[model samples]
Target chain A: MSDQEILRTTGLTMRFGGVTAVNNVNFSIDHEGELRCLLGPNGAGKSTFFKCLTGQLVPTEGTITFMGEPIAGMDTHEIVNLGIGIKTQVPNLFNGLSAYDNVRLAAKRKHLKRQAIEKTFDMLSNCGIENLKGSEVGLLSHGQRQLIELAMVLAAEPTLVLLDEPAAGMTGEERDRLAFLVKEVTKTASVIVVEHDMAFIKQIAKNVTVFHRGEIFAEDDVKKIMKNKSVQEIYLGKSADAA
Target chain B: MEKSILKDPGLYVMVSIGLLIMIFLPIMMDMFAIMQITQYVVLSVYALSLAYIWGYGGILSFGQSCFFGLGAYTFAVASINMGSTSLPFILAIIIPALFGVLLGYFMFYGRLSDVYLGVVTLVVTLIFWKLINHTAGPQYAIGDARLGGFNGIPSIPILNMPTANGQMMDPIQMFVTFMAILIMVYVGLRLLIASEFGRVSISIRENEVRSSLLGYDVRRHKVVVFSIGCGIAGMSGAMWATYQTFIDPNAFSLEMSAKALVWVMAGGVGTLAGPIIAVVILQWISLKLGQLNIINNFVLLGLILVPLVLILPKGLLPTVKQWSQDLWTIWKKNKANEGDTIIKESETVNAGRRK
Candidate 1:
């Protein structure tokens, strides 16, 4: 992992109607292969921040630079074209298509016809659902669909990946598997994961950023973040007892 | 998943049956019947355009007759001025396609939702209907072709061969020509839907936001597909002019657009054979109903469409395809179970003999 900033957001703020979803804040990813976890409560503005990064919503005030270019107003497709991948909270797979087809569709955008087919199989196997290639995505279990969505994002071979609550509806075993998968992904790309599960975060994240009331409450290593008094009171909500 | 023509037994069977009917109908029937069949063939082409956009592209255009009527008028005006069918034919296709490009750019790029798209298109069709109906005065003439308004332009020139004297095509030649065009369009559409572009278009239809996140320009794809559909509709309109030897403002009416939609809905939206089959059967029934004096044909059409929508919401062809596939799976499972039982019995018998 090299010391190069892949993405940076300066003084980002997003307002919907009269409510401020994400207050002005500066965030940056300096290492190429670092796994950063975003921990926040519901409505902590983590989703809004993720959306701003992915170009789903333009921030009302701020400048987001990706790979040294301003991307605050770029379209979602344009952002993806710049080698950034996003997996929203919702498993937005094509329900009528098979698992293979879902990944194949994403692969086709960045690869040739023959290479797309090969990459699709490779990613599906990597995600541990190669046997379910022929099954429709709608027929798959929640964990299986989540894994497929991850495979689809990986198939594009992006340099940066953003995932929002990928383990929200998974079993304990599934979360363990997801932790391994996220670790494996960071070997090739920088990753920003928005999650609320403390155990899952401890397993996957080395660097943690806690958010509260649309602001960054704390930022540090997992051990220190869990030990911090303010983070425990505002985010963990139990002080030392929760720790 | 494999897109080989041979893999779809239904398509092969339908095409074969349709070809046989096209070949033998003229020999078995009178000239008037052949002419009516020719009209149905042209209408089938129009229905195909709707299916391409609505079924495959997920664009439910309500004013498709705008393109069709534009094609008819372009053919009439060009043919009257040049006294040749060749240039008019080319213009008929090109004019509507250009118009489609213009309309689609605004609608798709403007990010109009499906419901808004339907409303805008329907309003455009009504505008065309009103605009053309009021062009009945003698001043509305374009060169030698008069805009006959509600009465329509009569004695329009038929399609002619490109030879020196430009011999006019008779009813038989026209029927064969229209059938050939219909087949070509069907085969072309089938190949397109099987291509990579077609797969991406379907993905966009399934989920536009997901497709965009996957790096697809959803707006551009929609606009291109819309333009192609409009061009095809224009071709059908040109054929309509040649077949009837007359052009009318009714071609631009709401009824014409509604009928095209009905054909697609009654047949099946996505499959090529669905709309073609639906148009032929329904038109035949409509002609039969027309012979009776008691009931209006449109009312009878409404009656048939209501039941069809209720019973086969996915349309006839897709539902039938699903049923056949389900049956095939059940049969395969049953055969596997039978084989397992037979093998188990044989093993037990061998053990008993050894004991």
Candidate 2:
């Protein structure tokens, strides 16, 4: 176990009803100081995998170790306490509270002191919403809310941050900014981003995992996965003739 | 920069004024009328508790009345059974709080969701109501008095409050006693709403999944928040016991639950101040309405509620907020235009002098 390899899962499996959402999958990462992307098409079980790792859903069969501690059966709150933070695919924000307040709530969980308030503002500034902090998350643009959500997760100071579809509703410029922010986040903690957009994956991810139908289809450098023929076929479909 | 109404001076002023009215209302109004308002306010506390769960925690509890009833019964039984005459009022309060904690532990640890939790609570309330109603027969005796069936524990001892004179309190004194408690409870709730716990509760309401993912003990938080709300409901019940000097199974009925909810709804759900305002207004109206023929009373209620519901879905407070905001904005805009015109004229005058 290295400082970089903060989380690892062995033979993780998740089933819903009769559908095996995540099949037997063994994956580990030697933590690098950069964001990693788990890219897959719809029905590829990326979200399910993220949920399993975050303890939002229990894996039917798996051993998850966070910083060398078994976290498979731990509750979500306990997992978070052990330095894991998750940003949902949908912008899961308190609509009734201002953006600042949403971030403040998360910050208080990390620590509840006046000094923590400054750190929370710093986190919000990092996410590029320090100016619009007081505006309600409901009133914010889709991009701004996403940024606030990012700020919220950052406030927790987790060693491992999982973001699902963070830039789903963001504009191109917003997406680019988010990618940069994600890269910055990786400087302190390993960020595993589950996203569909290739552009974002290419921009931020130093390493990429292409998940295909509940299994790790490919895991390598971003450049290598993009060039891999089978990876492209499975993700983008075979060439026109083959199709 | 994270300024909220809680920090606003105007809010403090408004709260102070409201407190003042509550403090003096009993002196100005008839004893029975003031007692009725106090009961409604107590129910509002229950409503506020529900609002905390529903509006902030995002956990809908249909059986909130369970806690309310539980608190009331706990206080009544404990104080009565112990025969501790000196601190009956205090015992009444403490007992309910204990019940809240006990109930919270069961529901929260059980991992109950909103729908199932609500059903369980409603069933519990009904069961308790039935049991109490049925058990109030021949066997239930306290000292010399017999527990009246369908009729509740009547002749509840007058709440013994300490005053400067060291004399025992009359019924009017009990009104003052409960009124003081109501104010204190309101203030405590206000502070709680502004505390770190309150923030967590609101966050849970906003996004339980996300809040949980961020490391909140969502289930435990729900249970604790629910329990706290119940505890407050219990406090109100204790107050009710003191104010009316009576306790009955009917006090914990479906109608009581509905009225508590109505207070929350008629007041603004999310805002703390809204529940208080709504309770006061609705209680006053309902009292006035009750004076009319029963048939006309309900019809009149519909006439008022229809327009109120239609016009202010956020309740009266939102309407007041909107109206106030509009006025402030117009005033500010006018001030800005005037300043701009003055600046333009001054600039022109400066140019003329240069020429």
Tens-digit lDDT string for candidate 1 (A1-243): 677789999999999999999998789998789889998889999989998988888899999999889999888888989989988898889999899999988888789999999999999988888998999999888878889999999999999999989998888887887899899999999999998788788888899988887888888999998888778877777633442
Candidate 2 Cα errors over 4 Å, as ranges: A1-4, A32-35, A96-136, A221-224, A227-230, A238-243, B2-15, B22-48, B51-56, B85-88, B105-117, B140-148, B162-168, B294-299, B335-355
- Model 1 pairs whose backbones collide: none
- Chain A TM-score for each candidate, in the given order? 0.95, 0.92
- Candidate 2 residues B193-302, lDDT tens each? 67768877877776778878777788888777776777777667766665666888876687677666666676767766677777778777877888865666656767
Off by over 4 Å in 1: A13-20, A23-25, A58-61, A112-115, A211-218, A227-243, B5-15, B163-165, B325-355
Worst 10 residues of 1 chain A by lDDT: A234-243
Error of 2 at A206 (Å): 4.9
TM-score of chain B of 2: 0.84
lDDT of 2 by residue, A32-151 (tens): 454678988888999998888878888899888888899887788998899888888878888977878788778877686785788788988888778888787888787788888889
True contacts kept of 1: 0.73
lDDT of 1 by residue, B300-353 (tens): 878988989999998888988889999999999999999999999999999999
Q: State the C-alpha RMSD over the true interface residues for candidate 2, after superposing those residues.
A: 1.7
Model 1's DockQ score: 0.66
